[model samples]
Target: MVKIVALVGTNSENSTNRQLLQYMKAHFANQAELELLEINHLPLFDKPADKKVPEVVRQMALTIESADGVVISTPEYDHAIPAALLNALNWLSYGIYPFVDKPVMIIGASYGTLGSSRAQAHLRQVLDAPELKARIMPSSEFLLSHSLQAFDENNELIDQDMVAQLEGLFEDFLVFMQITSQLGHAHSVNQKLAESVSWENR
Candidate 1:
Protein backbone atom coordinates (compact mmCIF):
# COMPACT_ATOMS: atom_id res chain seq x y z
CA MET A 1 0.00 0.00 0.00
CA VAL A 2 1.09 3.58 -0.62
CA LYS A 3 2.37 5.25 2.56
CA ILE A 4 1.19 8.82 3.03
CA VAL A 5 1.90 11.35 5.79
CA ALA A 6 -0.91 13.67 6.86
CA LEU A 7 -0.24 16.92 8.69
CA VAL A 8 -2.73 19.24 10.37
CA GLY A 9 -1.07 22.65 10.10
CA THR A 10 -1.82 24.08 13.50
CA ASN A 11 -0.64 23.83 17.06
CA SER A 12 -4.08 23.94 18.62
CA GLU A 13 -5.32 20.82 20.35
CA ASN A 14 -8.88 21.89 19.50
CA SER A 15 -8.17 22.57 15.86
CA THR A 16 -10.90 22.01 13.30
CA ASN A 17 -8.23 21.62 10.67
CA ARG A 18 -6.93 18.57 12.50
CA GLN A 19 -10.47 17.25 12.74
CA LEU A 20 -10.94 17.64 9.02
CA LEU A 21 -7.70 15.78 8.39
CA GLN A 22 -8.72 12.86 10.59
CA TYR A 23 -12.10 12.77 8.88
CA MET A 24 -10.43 12.58 5.48
CA LYS A 25 -8.24 9.72 6.71
CA ALA A 26 -11.23 7.37 6.72
CA HIS A 27 -11.75 7.95 3.02
CA PHE A 28 -8.21 6.90 2.13
CA ALA A 29 -7.74 4.13 4.70
CA ASN A 30 -8.57 1.28 2.36
CA GLN A 31 -6.60 2.72 -0.55
CA ALA A 32 -3.52 3.99 1.30
CA GLU A 33 -1.88 4.06 4.70
CA LEU A 34 -2.19 7.48 6.32
CA GLU A 35 0.03 8.45 9.25
CA LEU A 36 -0.90 11.66 11.00
CA LEU A 37 2.19 13.68 11.95
CA GLU A 38 1.53 16.24 14.65
CA ILE A 39 3.23 19.58 14.26
CA ASN A 40 2.59 20.58 17.87
CA HIS A 41 5.01 17.95 19.09
CA LEU A 42 7.86 19.64 17.29
CA PRO A 43 9.96 21.98 19.34
CA LEU A 44 9.48 25.57 18.32
CA PHE A 45 12.54 26.42 16.27
CA ASP A 46 13.72 29.74 17.62
CA LYS A 47 17.04 29.48 15.83
CA PRO A 48 17.62 30.85 12.39
CA ALA A 49 16.77 28.84 9.26
CA ASP A 50 20.46 28.05 8.83
CA LYS A 51 20.67 26.42 12.24
CA LYS A 52 20.84 22.67 12.69
CA VAL A 53 17.66 20.67 13.25
CA PRO A 54 16.81 19.32 16.67
CA GLU A 55 16.77 15.53 17.22
CA VAL A 56 12.99 15.32 17.38
CA VAL A 57 12.59 17.36 14.26
CA ARG A 58 15.12 15.15 12.51
CA GLN A 59 13.14 12.04 13.36
CA MET A 60 9.92 13.59 12.14
CA ALA A 61 11.69 14.55 8.95
CA LEU A 62 12.71 10.95 8.44
CA THR A 63 9.17 9.72 8.95
CA ILE A 64 7.93 12.20 6.37
CA GLU A 65 10.74 11.26 4.01
CA SER A 66 9.73 7.61 4.14
CA ALA A 67 6.23 8.42 2.97
CA ASP A 68 5.23 8.29 -0.69
CA GLY A 69 3.08 11.39 -0.51
CA VAL A 70 1.84 14.08 1.88
CA VAL A 71 -1.51 15.72 2.71
CA ILE A 72 -1.65 19.01 4.59
CA SER A 73 -4.85 20.17 6.26
CA THR A 74 -4.21 23.84 6.95
CA PRO A 75 -5.97 26.71 8.68
CA GLU A 76 -5.73 30.39 7.81
CA TYR A 77 -4.53 33.01 10.30
CA ASP A 78 -4.35 36.64 9.29
CA HIS A 79 -4.46 35.58 5.64
CA ALA A 80 -1.41 33.39 6.08
CA ILE A 81 -0.39 29.98 7.39
CA PRO A 82 -0.18 29.60 11.12
CA ALA A 83 3.26 30.40 12.59
CA ALA A 84 3.76 26.98 14.14
CA LEU A 85 3.07 25.15 10.91
CA LEU A 86 5.35 27.40 8.93
CA ASN A 87 8.06 26.89 11.53
CA ALA A 88 7.82 23.12 11.23
CA LEU A 89 8.21 23.45 7.46
CA ASN A 90 11.22 25.72 7.81
CA TRP A 91 12.99 23.14 9.96
CA LEU A 92 12.22 20.42 7.43
CA SER A 93 13.89 22.49 4.73
CA TYR A 94 17.14 22.70 6.68
CA GLY A 95 17.82 19.00 6.78
CA ILE A 96 17.74 16.51 3.90
CA TYR A 97 14.94 18.39 2.13
CA PRO A 98 12.35 15.62 2.49
CA PHE A 99 9.79 17.48 0.40
CA VAL A 100 12.02 17.82 -2.62
CA ASP A 101 10.08 16.39 -5.56
CA LYS A 102 7.61 14.76 -3.19
CA PRO A 103 3.97 14.78 -4.27
CA VAL A 104 1.75 16.84 -1.96
CA MET A 105 -1.96 17.62 -1.67
CA ILE A 106 -3.09 20.72 0.26
CA ILE A 107 -6.56 21.35 1.70
CA GLY A 108 -7.78 23.82 4.29
CA ALA A 109 -10.62 24.88 6.59
CA SER A 110 -11.38 28.40 7.79
CA TYR A 111 -14.06 30.47 9.46
CA GLY A 112 -14.27 32.88 6.54
CA THR A 113 -16.20 32.26 3.35
CA LEU A 114 -13.02 31.85 1.38
CA GLY A 115 -12.00 28.95 3.56
CA SER A 116 -8.23 28.87 4.05
CA SER A 117 -7.62 29.50 0.37
CA ARG A 118 -5.21 32.34 1.02
CA ALA A 119 -3.19 30.28 3.46
CA GLN A 120 -3.22 27.37 1.05
CA ALA A 121 -1.81 29.61 -1.69
CA HIS A 122 0.97 30.76 0.61
CA LEU A 123 1.77 27.16 1.50
CA ARG A 124 1.94 26.13 -2.14
CA GLN A 125 4.37 28.93 -2.81
CA VAL A 126 6.54 27.84 0.09
CA LEU A 127 6.50 24.22 -1.01
CA ASP A 128 7.39 25.15 -4.57
CA ALA A 129 10.19 27.43 -3.54
CA PRO A 130 13.57 26.55 -5.07
CA GLU A 131 15.00 25.24 -1.80
CA LEU A 132 12.14 22.87 -0.93
CA LYS A 133 10.70 21.88 -4.32
CA ALA A 134 7.55 20.00 -3.25
CA ARG A 135 5.31 19.02 -6.14
CA ILE A 136 1.71 19.95 -5.22
CA MET A 137 -1.24 18.21 -6.85
CA PRO A 138 -2.27 20.67 -9.55
CA SER A 139 -5.73 19.30 -10.26
CA SER A 140 -7.81 20.75 -7.43
CA GLU A 141 -7.75 22.24 -3.94
CA PHE A 142 -10.38 21.17 -1.38
CA LEU A 143 -11.28 24.18 0.74
CA LEU A 144 -13.85 24.17 3.54
CA SER A 145 -15.20 27.63 4.28
CA HIS A 146 -17.52 28.43 7.18
CA SER A 147 -15.99 25.22 8.38
CA LEU A 148 -17.86 24.89 11.64
CA GLN A 149 -21.14 24.57 9.75
CA ALA A 150 -19.60 22.32 7.15
CA PHE A 151 -19.48 19.42 9.55
CA ASP A 152 -22.15 17.65 11.55
CA GLU A 153 -22.37 16.82 15.28
CA ASN A 154 -20.60 13.51 14.74
CA ASN A 155 -17.42 15.40 13.78
CA GLU A 156 -17.85 14.33 10.20
CA LEU A 157 -17.86 16.50 7.14
CA ILE A 158 -21.41 16.82 5.85
CA ASP A 159 -20.82 18.71 2.66
CA GLN A 160 -21.47 16.34 -0.23
CA ASP A 161 -19.82 18.59 -2.80
CA MET A 162 -16.57 18.89 -0.86
CA VAL A 163 -16.57 15.17 -0.23
CA ALA A 164 -16.85 14.49 -3.93
CA GLN A 165 -14.07 16.94 -4.68
CA LEU A 166 -11.87 15.26 -2.08
CA GLU A 167 -12.39 11.86 -3.67
CA GLY A 168 -11.30 13.21 -7.03
CA LEU A 169 -8.30 14.94 -5.48
CA PHE A 170 -7.26 11.75 -3.74
CA GLU A 171 -7.37 9.84 -7.00
CA ASP A 172 -5.30 12.46 -8.72
CA PHE A 173 -2.80 12.50 -5.86
CA LEU A 174 -2.23 8.76 -6.08
CA VAL A 175 -1.50 9.04 -9.78
CA PHE A 176 0.79 11.98 -9.16
CA MET A 177 2.75 9.92 -6.64
CA GLN A 178 3.34 7.05 -9.02
CA ILE A 179 4.46 9.33 -11.83
CA THR A 180 6.76 11.43 -9.71
CA SER A 181 8.38 8.43 -8.06
CA GLN A 182 9.07 6.91 -11.46
CA LEU A 183 10.60 10.11 -12.73
CA GLY A 184 12.74 10.44 -9.64
CA HIS A 185 14.04 6.88 -9.95
CA ALA A 186 14.80 7.30 -13.64
CA HIS A 187 16.76 10.47 -13.02
CA SER A 188 18.76 8.82 -10.28
CA VAL A 189 19.66 5.94 -12.58
CA ASN A 190 20.76 8.27 -15.37
CA GLN A 191 22.90 10.30 -13.02
CA LYS A 192 24.59 7.19 -11.68
CA LEU A 193 25.25 5.91 -15.18
CA ALA A 194 26.84 9.20 -16.21
CA GLU A 195 29.12 9.12 -13.15
CA SER A 196 30.11 5.51 -13.87
CA VAL A 197 30.98 6.32 -17.49
CA SER A 198 33.07 9.28 -16.43
CA TRP A 199 34.92 7.16 -13.87
CA GLU A 200 35.59 4.47 -16.51
CA ASN A 201 37.02 7.11 -18.91
CA ARG A 202 39.28 8.44 -16.12
Candidate 2:
Protein backbone atom coordinates (compact mmCIF):
# COMPACT_ATOMS: atom_id res chain seq x y z
CA MET A 1 0.00 0.00 0.00
CA VAL A 2 1.08 3.52 -0.72
CA LYS A 3 1.63 5.14 2.68
CA ILE A 4 1.45 8.90 3.00
CA VAL A 5 1.63 11.03 6.14
CA ALA A 6 -0.05 14.37 6.70
CA LEU A 7 1.88 16.98 8.66
CA VAL A 8 -0.61 19.52 10.01
CA GLY A 9 0.48 23.01 10.95
CA THR A 10 -0.81 25.29 13.70
CA ASN A 11 -0.86 24.18 17.28
CA SER A 12 -4.32 25.68 17.67
CA GLU A 13 -6.82 23.74 19.69
CA ASN A 14 -9.39 23.96 16.92
CA SER A 15 -7.19 24.03 13.92
CA THR A 16 -9.05 24.09 10.64
CA ASN A 17 -5.98 22.85 8.82
CA ARG A 18 -6.17 19.72 10.90
CA GLN A 19 -9.79 19.33 9.99
CA LEU A 20 -9.00 19.71 6.32
CA LEU A 21 -6.36 17.05 6.57
CA GLN A 22 -8.75 14.70 8.32
CA TYR A 23 -11.16 15.13 5.45
CA MET A 24 -8.49 14.42 2.88
CA LYS A 25 -7.27 11.35 4.72
CA ALA A 26 -10.76 9.89 4.63
CA HIS A 27 -11.27 11.07 1.09
CA PHE A 28 -8.23 9.15 -0.09
CA ALA A 29 -8.88 6.10 2.10
CA ASN A 30 -9.48 3.67 -0.74
CA GLN A 31 -6.49 4.81 -2.77
CA ALA A 32 -3.75 5.18 -0.17
CA GLU A 33 -3.04 4.70 3.51
CA LEU A 34 -2.99 8.34 4.65
CA GLU A 35 -1.97 8.85 8.27
CA LEU A 36 -1.69 11.98 10.34
CA LEU A 37 1.57 13.08 11.98
CA GLU A 38 0.70 14.65 15.31
CA ILE A 39 3.10 17.55 15.72
CA ASN A 40 1.58 18.95 18.91
CA HIS A 41 3.97 17.00 21.09
CA LEU A 42 6.99 18.40 19.26
CA PRO A 43 9.00 20.91 21.21
CA LEU A 44 10.65 24.04 19.83
CA PHE A 45 13.50 23.81 17.36
CA ASP A 46 16.30 22.92 19.72
CA LYS A 47 18.93 21.40 17.46
CA PRO A 48 19.37 17.75 18.32
CA ALA A 49 23.18 18.00 18.12
CA ASP A 50 23.46 19.46 21.62
CA LYS A 51 20.18 18.77 23.39
CA LYS A 52 18.50 15.46 24.00
CA VAL A 53 15.91 14.90 21.33
CA PRO A 54 12.38 14.32 22.56
CA GLU A 55 10.86 10.90 21.98
CA VAL A 56 8.04 12.54 20.03
CA VAL A 57 10.52 14.26 17.78
CA ARG A 58 12.31 11.02 17.07
CA GLN A 59 9.00 9.33 16.25
CA MET A 60 8.04 12.23 13.97
CA ALA A 61 11.25 11.88 12.01
CA LEU A 62 10.78 8.13 11.70
CA THR A 63 7.19 8.57 10.49
CA ILE A 64 8.25 10.93 7.74
CA GLU A 65 11.21 8.81 6.73
CA SER A 66 9.09 5.69 6.50
CA ALA A 67 6.22 7.22 4.52
CA ASP A 68 6.09 6.98 0.75
CA GLY A 69 5.17 10.68 0.55
CA VAL A 70 4.16 13.66 2.69
CA VAL A 71 1.16 15.97 2.66
CA ILE A 72 1.64 19.27 4.42
CA SER A 73 -1.59 20.97 5.46
CA THR A 74 -0.76 24.34 6.87
CA PRO A 75 -2.37 27.60 7.90
CA GLU A 76 -1.11 31.12 7.27
CA TYR A 77 0.22 33.28 10.06
CA ASP A 78 1.49 36.74 9.11
CA HIS A 79 1.71 35.63 5.50
CA ALA A 80 3.97 32.72 6.39
CA ILE A 81 3.72 29.11 7.40
CA PRO A 82 2.92 28.74 11.10
CA ALA A 83 6.00 28.92 13.29
CA ALA A 84 5.22 25.62 14.92
CA LEU A 85 5.27 23.85 11.58
CA LEU A 86 8.48 25.53 10.52
CA ASN A 87 10.07 24.71 13.83
CA ALA A 88 9.18 21.04 13.42
CA LEU A 89 10.67 21.08 9.96
CA ASN A 90 13.80 22.75 11.27
CA TRP A 91 14.27 19.93 13.74
CA LEU A 92 13.66 17.34 11.04
CA SER A 93 16.14 19.09 8.75
CA TYR A 94 19.05 18.66 11.15
CA GLY A 95 18.51 15.18 12.50
CA ILE A 96 17.68 12.19 10.30
CA TYR A 97 17.28 14.21 7.08
CA PRO A 98 13.83 12.77 6.55
CA PHE A 99 12.75 15.59 4.33
CA VAL A 100 15.78 15.27 2.10
CA ASP A 101 14.48 14.52 -1.38
CA LYS A 102 11.10 13.48 0.03
CA PRO A 103 8.14 13.92 -2.30
CA VAL A 104 5.69 16.42 -0.73
CA MET A 105 2.28 17.80 -1.57
CA ILE A 106 1.16 21.11 -0.09
CA ILE A 107 -2.36 22.11 0.86
CA GLY A 108 -3.65 24.83 3.14
CA ALA A 109 -6.70 26.46 4.67
CA SER A 110 -7.45 29.95 5.94
CA TYR A 111 -10.39 32.08 7.01
CA GLY A 112 -9.13 35.09 5.07
CA THR A 113 -10.06 35.84 1.50
CA LEU A 114 -6.72 34.98 -0.06
CA GLY A 115 -6.41 31.61 1.58
CA SER A 116 -2.96 30.34 2.51
CA SER A 117 -1.32 30.91 -0.85
CA ARG A 118 1.37 33.18 0.52
CA ALA A 119 2.22 30.76 3.29
CA GLN A 120 2.48 27.88 0.85
CA ALA A 121 4.80 29.95 -1.34
CA HIS A 122 6.99 30.71 1.63
CA LEU A 123 6.92 27.05 2.65
CA ARG A 124 8.13 26.05 -0.80
CA GLN A 125 11.14 28.26 -0.28
CA VAL A 126 11.84 26.66 3.08
CA LEU A 127 11.54 23.15 1.64
CA ASP A 128 13.92 24.13 -1.15
CA ALA A 129 16.66 24.83 1.37
CA PRO A 130 19.73 22.61 1.16
CA GLU A 131 19.00 20.80 4.40
CA LEU A 132 15.47 19.79 3.47
CA LYS A 133 15.57 19.61 -0.33
CA ALA A 134 11.95 18.47 -0.51
CA ARG A 135 10.60 17.65 -3.96
CA ILE A 136 7.19 19.39 -3.94
CA MET A 137 4.52 18.58 -6.45
CA PRO A 138 4.45 20.66 -9.66
CA SER A 139 0.71 20.95 -10.04
CA SER A 140 -1.67 23.78 -9.31
CA GLU A 141 -1.70 24.48 -5.60
CA PHE A 142 -4.64 23.62 -3.33
CA LEU A 143 -5.78 26.45 -1.12
CA LEU A 144 -9.00 26.49 0.88
CA SER A 145 -10.21 29.99 1.47
CA HIS A 146 -12.85 30.89 4.05
CA SER A 147 -12.21 27.42 5.27
CA LEU A 148 -15.16 27.28 7.66
CA GLN A 149 -17.71 27.49 4.88
CA ALA A 150 -15.57 25.56 2.45
CA PHE A 151 -16.54 22.37 4.14
CA ASP A 152 -19.79 20.84 5.30
CA GLU A 153 -20.75 20.11 8.90
CA ASN A 154 -19.24 16.69 8.44
CA ASN A 155 -16.02 18.27 7.15
CA GLU A 156 -16.47 17.18 3.60
CA LEU A 157 -15.26 19.70 1.01
CA ILE A 158 -18.61 20.72 -0.51
CA ASP A 159 -17.57 22.27 -3.76
CA GLN A 160 -18.03 19.73 -6.49
CA ASP A 161 -15.68 21.64 -8.75
CA MET A 162 -12.96 21.65 -6.12
CA VAL A 163 -13.64 17.99 -5.49
CA ALA A 164 -13.04 17.27 -9.15
CA GLN A 165 -9.86 19.29 -9.04
CA LEU A 166 -8.64 17.33 -6.03
CA GLU A 167 -9.33 14.12 -7.87
CA GLY A 168 -6.91 15.27 -10.53
CA LEU A 169 -4.40 16.46 -7.96
CA PHE A 170 -4.53 13.16 -6.12
CA GLU A 171 -3.92 11.27 -9.34
CA ASP A 172 -0.89 13.38 -10.16
CA PHE A 173 0.37 13.09 -6.59
CA LEU A 174 0.23 9.29 -6.76
CA VAL A 175 2.32 9.24 -9.93
CA PHE A 176 4.79 11.64 -8.37
CA MET A 177 5.21 9.35 -5.38
CA GLN A 178 5.86 6.36 -7.65
CA ILE A 179 8.61 8.20 -9.52
CA THR A 180 10.18 9.43 -6.29
CA SER A 181 10.13 5.93 -4.84
CA GLN A 182 12.21 4.74 -7.80
CA LEU A 183 14.65 7.59 -7.26
CA GLY A 184 14.90 6.82 -3.54
CA HIS A 185 15.68 3.17 -4.28
CA ALA A 186 18.47 4.14 -6.64
CA HIS A 187 19.88 6.65 -4.17
CA SER A 188 19.86 4.07 -1.37
CA VAL A 189 21.79 1.59 -3.51
CA ASN A 190 24.35 4.24 -4.42
CA GLN A 191 24.83 5.14 -0.78
CA LYS A 192 25.49 1.49 0.14
CA LEU A 193 28.06 1.17 -2.63
CA ALA A 194 29.86 4.34 -1.49
CA GLU A 195 29.91 3.10 2.11
CA SER A 196 31.35 -0.25 1.03
CA VAL A 197 34.15 1.44 -0.89
CA SER A 198 35.03 3.61 2.12
CA TRP A 199 35.07 0.56 4.38
CA GLU A 200 37.32 -1.40 1.99
CA ASN A 201 39.90 1.44 1.93
CA ARG A 202 40.00 1.70 5.74
Worst-scoring 10-residue span by lDDT in model 2? 193-202
lDDT (C-alpha, whole model) for all candidates: 0.82, 0.82
Model 1: runs farther than 4 Å from truth? 48-51, 185-202
For candidate 1, write residues 134-163 as lDDT tens digits: 779885788889987887887777888888
CA lDDT, candidate 2, residue 131? 62
Give stretches of model 2 more than 4 Å off: 48-51, 185-202
Across 13-104, the per-residue lDDT of candidate 2 in tens digits comes to 88889998899889999999999886777777754455556777778889898999999988999999988888888777653467777899
Q: Per-candidate TM vs. native?
A: 0.87, 0.88
**Cα RMSD (Å) per model?**
6.4, 5.1
Judged by TM-score, which candidate is best? 2
